[model samples]
Target: MVDRYVAAVDQGTTSTRCILFDHAGRLAAVAQREHRQHLPRPGWVEHDAQEILRNVLRVVGEAVQDVGAGPGQVVALGIANQRETTVLWDPRTGQPYGHAVVWQDLRTEARVEELAADGGRDRFRDVCGLPLTTYFAGPRIAWLLDATPGLRDAAAAGHVLFGTVDSWLVWNLTGGPDGGVHVTDVTNASRTMLMDLAGRHWSPALCEAMGVPMQILPEIRSSAEVYGLTGGPVAEVLPGVPVAAALGDQQAALFGQTCFAPGEAKCTYGTGSFVLINTGATPVTAEHGTLPTVAYQIGDEPAAYALEGAIAVTGSLVQWFRDGLGMIATAPDIEGLALSVPDNGGCYIVPAFSGLFAPHWRPDARGVVVGLTSFVTRAHLARAVLEATAWQTRDVVDAMDADSGLRLTSLRVDGGMTSNNLLMQTVADVLGVPVVRPMVSETVSLGAAYAAGLAVGWWPDLEGLRRNWHRAGEWLPHADPAAVARGHEDWTRAVQHSFGWSREPSSHDGGAPSAQPGR
Candidate 1:
């Protein structure tokens, strides 16, 4: 019997999650599995693409089975994925040439340096709406082609395909090694640094400049449209279910937060934290460190654009406290440890683990812990860890305000970290704006489900999605104005100590060429 349920596959940097949403936009069942993050060397990160594929299949089956729903009950499937992670696979065998290069990986730093030498960073910003940074997939894809043996020739011959996580899953879901559809939504394509922002297609000049073959690029489609039906192992759980929507994780959260109108904003705190403000219809070229991207595109409506502030580290700071420092047993223990200390105790931590992103695109920066004295304890360090997350949000929020000319009075926030009352209140205090959390914290997956449901007539239009949103709670600013100023002042000083720490002795600048844009 036909039913009105949508399945969303939220493929993130650290885990794969599958959520089933009922007609009213409530979660019926959910399942998630964390994958291994391979650090072959310092400043490098990777994931086994094939393992992610297996985990995705596992979670989808588990979520669907939890609610005792058959394939007929699941009307469609949508995808929301960690953007800019480059994956290259063979079309003939459906096997990745190597482990997927994560967005946090710095393996392509030298390549970006070369691009910066030729022209200081904003070389392709006009056409592609991105800068010459390792944060994008273009350089990573180029590095994969150069580092992997014979991959370039194979790409040139069209034997290989290149895509972010979404394309990899969509191809495998449709029917890997057979005739699966190879496509990605506009939101994902916008991050590749190879797609034309205005044209909404691959830019030939930028592609050639980045040394990527155009033949391997996937077809770009609207965020809310049926790309193909599920096949292969995915078909076993929901055969013939239409895979209707695909969006980058940040954009998915924006959609899920119901930030439909212009100037509406949201910050998603996950492995990384991102601040995106919606700029309706026409794209705004960013002069600040912010990058302009497509929020989402419906069937016939003009594409909505966004100005994004991408922070390289947030939740990962907590992970380091747990795993690297051995300060806590689990991820949640940091909050308790942090609460033991009233303040940061004159210490600050700049988690430039893979280098700082947004506002300060200093790729040469490394993680730094400043103002440490004999009096400091693990509790103080823990407080600094949580404080780092809040300060980083302020960095992006300030940049967003400058680029968009709209000051945010309140922020709609979601993700795993929103559960921490201390972090939420700190964010409010740091930004001087109310931090609002939605009743449904799983906005990432819900956004994908909403897009897919809209495509297949499960939800008629935007009004239906707006009706599904409701606030769960809020955090108002409580910190004294003087304290806030002093905290931000110390944070600024600590961040300065982090810059140029990772570069060679001779390089005073952040490893980029001395030439600035227009020089």
Candidate 2:
């Protein structure tokens, strides 16, 4: 008998990857390709949707071939994408109007401020469970509609279609411009600021406020269901496989980590770091800066809610260090450079490169490296870079505790950055809890595969998926409490220096002039 597998495509900030998972939740094979990041202007980031889709096809084919599996041997395909990367396309031609606005792009910052001017950022918090931040799809869509001539009119007439990356992939995969299914999962829709949290449908008032047309929206579906099948261009690789699930990459990580119960939490440290705590059936209001979001929804089941603390700079900070500064030869080299120093040498780096997120949603803030002195060396700066991510996670954990009213005892961690032992230990030390990595580190793809498999009855249930989780490594808190408190206080002081540094209008163009040295 041939072994069956579930395939998942993880459309990330900087790359697209396809992974195959066996029934026991073990990774069978994987293929990935990085797409170009277009930064036309300061504080702007865009991606060619066409390039991403092509890479998706290539990676999918490569992953399947790597496993020596035929299309029939693959049970289902799922998608986990970088949420809020907005794409608007002409359904007639299956062509995007422009590049997809990345979640990290702050080009919509002015629009966000204008919307929040009257009602403040929490104006639509009750309706959408999201603040008016540049990190969502709504403002980006609005900006595109306004910036592009006749786009609003086209959208109203149903000539244009709006979706996050998941909807885009599913549409094209099923059969773009050839009777493709246009739909978005509840998890991805929840991040759009156009969906009603309780109702689990598009909020009419939000669509009007964001200048988005209801006609352009996709049919909102559950995270796990047979939405469509690979029929069009996708047929060349995954022909006729059930497209079973879709999720925001962070939410996918939560599901992938098997945090199925209330108060259970996971943090994915990727391009950005997101800490999500399962709040169960009820959507927890954002009282403490954490965004309430749909974790995942099975077929017809009530949507599971999570409180998320989104940090905009974690792994990307490392990328900037490598590419922007040429400080290290590679991303992983920073770990060894950091270990060369016993400590941060009284330095702290608050990586608010595109402003801070979570606990402090200060868009005006910029990255800052403080406590710098002549005594500090390049090695110390590397240590400070790693510590910045740990401190940010600590901030989110604190906020999650307040919002959910549940203390995080231990955190299930995943993503590329988790492999750094120093960073993992720093996270455990900062949070005073055990930081644990699962045997399978690619939880985003795994979660998508798990949901897909569950939908197709390949996996028994959540209990079985939970049993597949095995610990690969663990880091425990080892720092002195008093010393840790002092360090945190200093870090907080450094964070304060980042705020109010970019208050002027043109300052939003990119990082503050003062932040240039740090970057």
Candidate 3:
């Protein structure tokens, strides 16, 4: 059943999207649905795992139906979900115990502080390419077990399944009421603190340290391997379709954008912006606390490793301007309004609304805006917000280069935010490298397409995806070094002003994580 098309279900932070690609790597159809984000308390974020699963089913069905394809026509399914969004579910019934604790949720900040205070925060860079923080799944899962009553019982009964969204959906889709496969791809597993980077399996030491049991975990597998066919109730849409790939959104983007060579990088501008540098076969253990994780795994490529840089707030900040403050009518309107001002006009925003990530793992860091003057208008604030995203990413790229030794010459940019030409050009000017935008901004979906195609023989391997890749636009270095330097200096000072402040309880006792403390 080699239909000329591959389907990708990209379950992203703000939306669930499905994209269909023909045999030649051309996009045939796309379906997107925006779901709700529940913020019950400040500094907390959540999504309904069941609702997300529903969206994935609905969108994929519509995409295939619009393309006039059936189960036999759609050869394989690849899933790339928002990484680090932790889900704890009843393995037997496929029901989430509570809302999916979003990657952005800071409810675990106190837990991270508890670990750090107990000396567990010391040199976490060894096995898990991350520190003790709320960003990863370990703390969130612990919070659920300790805080959610039924969870501990479920875990002890061996019925609780812990996973990022990829594992959750895969289990539900292929994991049936009778018996569905419970597995997670390596790329997504790397983000959880449980997996050992070198061994590429759940680490006993890590599980013990994080107060989690090994029994409830899923068997970790590679990104491109066929977990199973989509044979559950959702199969009502595309019956008997092979689910070939499951990757974290960032790794999927890296693969989808053809960043195969070492040092190749891509920046995804979603709810939170992510910058990942492909370090190739060998894992680059971050000397400076930049996340080191698996990029992706294919047939026998060993596990391609990567260095990750995360900006906890990117597109979400734009949402703040649109929804919270009512600055702009829509998200896209931000680029034009920000372009109205040449600069931040002495206003700088550090969106540590939860806590800052990457290079710096401070859970006490808080969002700050410095140098707000009487002359500051919505446009200046808008420009500052856009520039803030660029600045944070620039710091991440710098840290990535330092740690990986891959002199990043350019960055492939995707996600919802890259549509802003002003932001892309500004990111280029600040980083002093070309920022490339691809023909398909939905790199997650495209990466999923590549994976599903390869597994089912609709497309070749990574090289085949590379050959089919093409660029739509590129933002070259557009700022003088001196000007960028001065702007950065001002940004650095404002950053220092925002350090040690947090949206956490007083136990953590500092601001939420600060900016990447000056390289």
Candidate 4:
């Protein structure tokens, strides 16, 4: 690879992004486009798969131009994406059957309950390292097959193909219908509930249970591997440039945050918040409700495991405050607005905007604000929103610690929400551990760069990657532990009240609730 630059695609739920990072891991430029969010029914969300592809191309071209770097300087291209967004399309024409079933879509709650009632959910989770829910791809794939006409037959006849965003992009970039490599990284595949956690292959039992054809699935590959070359319309930028690495965005962020050692964890605050603890090369099965996931897989090496806590809301609540309610003029203004009030004023906000996840595992919960009084102003409401995220994060941390038997020395945080000083401060106070902020907030892409750079010798190894990690700041708790403890109790109470609240979509049909956006 002659070039020192890498083009990293970080596609998310609300937007598609492309960023350029040099070999030294410095940010060069970024291009992003917010696409349409379709809510065909309450609690259900979808995105056009083809529009996502279009946004990717536009953003990639723009980012390259911004840095005066194009495909030629892009030594390698790496992909990191929102895991569990299931895509199904015509193999012959490369056209999607309909919108992509977003991770936030809640259309399969009743179906999940049906599986659980049948006694198959428990057995599958034991083998797959994931629970039976709409949060994973297997269920979404099943939903698409059962809801869409001819999809089942098409999949069976090998006329349709299934993939997460990584597989979709690879197929489009490498010649789409003409023929692109069909592959998914182990990280993304892990969220599908179809891949064996230990063997890392599509499990026959899981597929049969979900009623999906194995032929439609992509071959799972290691996180860091040269998948193939670009061959489609966008090939002019850098034809035959190797696609070196691929990872689920959260896993990429974990690597990018330099959490290479066991027990090291990071929480990425975005539309939703996910906390992942790296437990290198050993599947640390959690007896306590946390999930065991593959952090990353390299070559034939043993897979790294993680204990994950999935929260539905984080920054989006703040977005709602600004856009939906007009509580604040802008998102960044939330920090000051929240800080304007000394506390939540005895109020607790349970942001189960879609539903609650992990520890509680309740699909019936909805967003609620408890302990409200006339004295509570918008500032207090703002503060409650920020505090709620911290409290929810602590819940995950506590569960992870209980399950893994590892006390966290500090919690590493990244993503757009981490930029808020007040939120970070509150998070530190609540977690009772120092919150370490990295110099590069875009750890998602950096993780992709780390894996891809290591693949082609741009990086010598994990040690070199850690040595180059740049930490920006650290925040520690300065408040009374007792007060924080009381605040946590209040938050839990608010969570309970959030349940059976009105106006939130519970399920697609009548099963376990779909995992919606947490904010």
Models ranked on lDDT = 2, 1, 4, 3
Number of colliding residue pairs in model 2: 0
Cα deviation at 157, candidate 1, in Å, is: 3.5
> Weakest 10 consecutive residues, lDDT, candidate 1?
510-519
lDDT tens readout by residue for model 2, 218-254: 9999999998889887798788899999998889999
lDDT of 1 by residue, 320-413 (tens): 8999989999999888888988998999999988567777777677899999999899999999999998998998888888888777888999
Which candidate would rank higher by TM-score, 1 or 4?
Answer: 4
After superposing candidate 4 on the true structure, give the runs of residues whose Cα lies further than 4 Å from its correct spot: 1-3, 70-72, 120-123, 323-326, 372-378, 500-513
Q: What's the lDDT for all of these models? A: 0.88, 0.88, 0.82, 0.83
Which residue pairs show backbone clashes in model 2?
none
Alpha-carbon RMSD of each model: 4.1, 3.5, 3.6, 2.9
Q: Model 3 over residues 5-28: C-alpha lDDT tens digits? A: 788998988899899888877889
Query: Which regions of candidate 3 are displaced past 4 Å?
Result: 1-3, 36-45, 147-154, 316-355, 362-382, 500-519
- Model 1 C-alpha RMSD to native: 4.1
Q: What is the lDDT of residue 131 in candidate 4?
A: 71
Pairs with steric clashes in candidate 4: 109-511, 109-512, 110-510, 110-511, 312-518, 313-518, 313-519
Q: How good is model 1 by TM-score?
A: 0.89
Q: How do all models score by TM-score?
A: 0.89, 0.91, 0.88, 0.91
Model 3 TM: 0.88
